[model samples]
Each structure stands twice: as C-alpha cells, then as structure tokens.
Target: MTDAAPQGRLRARSLGVAAGALPTGPLNAITDVDGVLVGHATVDDGADLHTGVTAVVPPRLGLPAAVHTGNGYGKLVGSTQVDELGVLESPIVLTATLSVFRAADAVLTYLMRLRPDGLSFNPLVGETNDGFLSDIRRRPITEQHVLDALEGACGGLPAEGCVGAGTGTTALGYKAGIGTSSRRLVADGAPVTVGALVQANFGGVLTVQGTPMPVEEVLPGVRHEEPPGNSCMIVVATDARLDARRLGRLARRAIFAMGRVGASYAHGSGDYAIAFTTAPPQRPPLPDDRLDPVFAAVMDAVEESLLNSLFTATTTTGVHGHTSHAVPYDRLPIRPGTGG
Candidate 1:
C-alpha cells in the first residue's frame, strides 16, 4: 500500500494517531475485504473539467451477493433484483449522475465481452452529481473509460482525492473524493473483516464529533458553503458470514456513523449505503443461519470506513472554478492521553 500523500498541493497529513486506537487492516482499505478489486477512470483534460468513473469488483469471479437495502434519494441501478433475490451477480460501477446510462452500457459491454458464452449481464451502477466540476451535459464518460476501469482493476491501496469519480467531488464545502477505510472485528471468539469505500460529494456546515466547527474555524478564507447538489454513495463489504437481512441492518448502521461525522442527511444530498457479506452461502429455509458473527464485523467495518473516507479526502477544485479546502491536520482537537 502506498503511504505517499495524494497528488495535490492541499493534501492532508497521515492519520497521525488522531484515529483513536482501532487497528486498521494491512492496507487500511476496502480492498482488504479479500478478493475485492478497485479501479479508476479519471478524466483530467486540462479543460477545467475533472470527472471520471470508478468500479469496485467484489470478486473477479463475480460472486453471487445481495444489496439487502435501498434508498430513494439516489440512483442505484440493478438493485431491485439484488434486494429481491439476495444476490448481486455483477460488479458495482460508480460514476457521475449524467453518465449513468453510458456507464451501465459500458459495464454490460465489458461483461458480455468477458463471457462471450451467451450469458446475460446485469450490473450494479451507482451515481452522484458532478455537474459542478465537469461537463456533465457532454457526458464525457465514454464506453472506453468504463472498460479501462474494469480492465485496470487490481488489489492494493486505492488512490484518493481527485481520482476516479471523486476527482471533482466535494464534502462539507471542502474538496473530497473517493476515500476508504476498514476494520477487523471479533465475534464468538472469531475475527472477521469489514470494509467501506465512499464516493463523497456532499457539503454542509462542517462538524466533528457533534461539535459545529465551520470551515472558518479551521482555515482562513475558507467559508461555510454548500455544493449545488451534494450526495454520497457508500459501499461496505465484509468477509464475515451474514445473510441478506443482517447485511441490510449493517448497512443502515453506517448512516449512524455518517451522523457522527456531522451529516444531517441534507435535503438534496443523496446519502445512501450498500453493504454485502462474502460469507459462504447457506441452504434454503435458513435466513438466520450463521449470521451473528458477521453482523458484528459489519458494524465495526462500517464505523472505521466512514472515518477513513474523511481522512483520505484532500482539497480539490472543479468546474465553475469552485474550490474546497482540505481539512487542516493541526486544527484537529486530538484528545489528550490519546497518541494521535
């Protein structure tokens, strides 16, 4: 995993003991969720348009899974079947709102090309608005871009800030993009892995741990502002054994962690979370079979992943020349006696 800071002048420092005592996974990323792969298709043409696509492949083999939860505020295609059947037989694609159709088509093409054996393809694709930073009207995300992301999928620490679909994204009026974090949990004397990856585009009055700290409190010239349309699509994955029902519960708990970070679920913000478990499948008539241990790990991973999203994001600038500042490390009120 790369310890190097993001590729921008406004990058923040490392976690620096500010993340409490929770032990992060080897890569401190969603990729640590075994067999998971992440890829990016960032478009930086120097035309003041910074936007792209990102794909998260739960397993290269396209394991059968489930969504288990749904949100009306955002666009999550191919989730209906996922919720009804408790299986997600495809990769999850993330891209700007306007490019959803193109992304979906591209994903279909990629899958078809991969398995040219006449097998049907139904992909899960999520979106958040990036019109403020990119020429969304032009729909710059081409079929080629989608294919590139799929072909480039690999395991390791994912690049953060100004990369992938998060390139022009913002959070709490600050520049934000794709951020990830993970955690390991113990249940029934067994360890499990849970992880989260987020495409952050929301904005609001910045706060930390319930304390209302506006941007001005931390950085001069930084104002308390909101994006034209703010939203976030968070994806959580776990290797612990969990049924679809338990996975839904775990996904809902992620919203609580979002609240802890000071998000009130803004009116225009399409805040949504999708969670899944890679535990071995159970036979029919056993919905609750072997799920307790996995639930515990899901909760632990969701909490840590939310924190990582915030930490990994760096300041960014986008279309219309809007700029969001990075969170200042020195301004963080690290608790005493805690080695942050």
Candidate 2:
C-alpha cells in the first residue's frame, strides 16, 4: 500500500524532457522497427499471481539475431544456437525463471504447427525472477499463455509497465515492469530506427540520465532487496542491416545503457541483451564505420526505455501482502504529468 502516483504513465522526454539528441519514431517503441511485433499475456489472479509472458516477433522467421551476456547468471534457453548460428527461427518469449523451459516448449509446439515437416528449430527465450509478488513455485505460466502471446502479436507501440513478463517485477526498490523507447537515425541516407524494449526487474540506485532518485525518501521503509538477485531481459530492434557479429557489438551497448540507468550488474543478476534488425542489404556490403549512429541511437533508446518502465509502473500489492511501490514521479528531476 503506497501513495498513488501523482501522474499517469509518461516517458522521460514528456515534460521538459531532454535525454537524447536523435528524434523518436511516432510510437517510440520497438515496433517502430517495421515488421517487429510485440504481444503480452498478463496473469493477475487478483491475488498472489502477478506473472505473465511477452512475445516479440521479427519480420520473418530465421532472421539475424545476437545476444550479449552482460552478467550471465540465469536461465536463457536457446542462447547457444543464437551464439553459434547468429539467427533466430522462432519468436522470442519472456517469462519468469522457472517457466522458461515451459515457454520454450510452447514456442516449439507452435513452430511445429507452422512447419511440421521441419527437423530443427530454435526458440529464443529469456526470463526475470518475479518472486517478489508472485508464487514462483506454482509456475503459473502455461503453454496456452505463450501461444496466446505469439498469436496476438502485432506491430505498434507496445503496452508498458505492470504487464507482460514485467508483472510482479521489482527494480531499484520500486514496482518496475515493461517499458520501451525508440530513436531514428539516417544511415547511408536511409532512415534507420533503433528501438528498445525492457523487462526492468534488476536493482541498484535508480538513476535517470545520471540523476539518482531517493527511493527511501519517496517510498519510505520500502524493502530494497526482496526480489533477490534479480535480472533484466532487454531486447533491441533496428532497421539497420547487420549480421550476427555486428549485432553482438550493438547488443553490448544496451547493457551499457542499463548501467547508465543504475544497474549494479549484481553477482546473481542475469543481465542479457539481444539485438536484431529487419533491414535487407541495400548494397554489396556495409562497412563498420556506418554503425556509429546506430550504436548511439541504441544507447539512448535503451536508457530511456528503462526509465519509462519505472515511471509508468504503479504501486502493486502481492504475495503475503508484500507491496512493490511505484517510483514517485515527483522524485524525478523532470516535470511530471505528461505523456510521450
């Protein structure tokens, strides 16, 4: 039980907000990357259950994808293939830790229906522990839930905070959840959009663009460590064409952005980021020098995406009456009460 947030959901640049130089797309979300779709299945039994699944669908199956292990410390299934082959065959699913295997199974089942005659497939899955507000032992997620997310996926600015895999998640002692942001860049005279989506469930002194928030002051007596060695699942999407090797380089920048927003990268934290693009080769081969603008866009978008997760999240009560309070918008340096 915490005081109501003074303002409604808003991104960092809403009220006199200025964090990045590049302009954002119309939606300012991962879906800003054409053909990239996102969907969520939130489970809120109106009781202790507050977990769900989030599915991200690329333009097509088997696209270039890569992951950067910022702090390898949790269950990330199908990562080895993505590391070795540098491609993804199935949609990416995000869920609770224990449900990762089940989520992957659900993905495979769906893929078989799409291609029954195929022999091999890889389902990219990532997770963040949401035990703070949900009974993790119950493993509330189901294959149908996974399927629903995938089937319902669509291209647009995704719903953020306290939905999808971010439900029941805690970050920087606040009730953090799903968030997204995007940046537009002109690469080789073509408009390139770099968008970021985040499951904000990790810890540290919460910072927004280098300014830290007084968590204890805003949410007095809030527990700073209930979630226990939490993790974050960050997904970056762009229209810039790059293979796995280059994608890996772009993926690491998302982690750097996480740090700027106050991720401690704890010993038990499983901080991971995956980067992909829907762009096709417009020329024989693109040089590495052209990636500089894309990298800068990724960094800013990821940073703002994390802050959006925190700002949009409202106070949530959970298992055993343990409440994860939302970060007070008034505590932020920028003026509140506006939307992006």
TM-score of 1: 0.87
Backbone clashes, candidate 1 = 6
Question: Which regions of candidate 2 fall more than 4 Å away from where they truly are?
Answer: 1-8, 281-285, 337-340
Model 1, position 140: C-alpha lDDT score: 91
Per-residue lDDT for 14-89 in model 1, tens only?
A: 4432232445577777898888889999997755677899988877444445553323577888888777776766
TM-score of each: 0.87, 0.94
- Cα RMSD for candidate 1? 3.3
Model 1 residue 110 lDDT score = 85
Best by lDDT: 2
Alpha carbon lDDT of residue 267, candidate 1? 74
Q: What is the lDDT of every predicted structure here? A: 0.69, 0.84
Q: Model 2, 1-340: lDDT tens per residue?
A: 1112223566566644544898888787888889999999999986899999999898888778899999999888999999998887788899999888999999999999999899988888999999889888899899999999999999866888899898889887788898888889897777789999999899888876578775776677765555785899999988787888888999999999888888878987899999887877453324688888888999999988888788778788888788888877677776654433
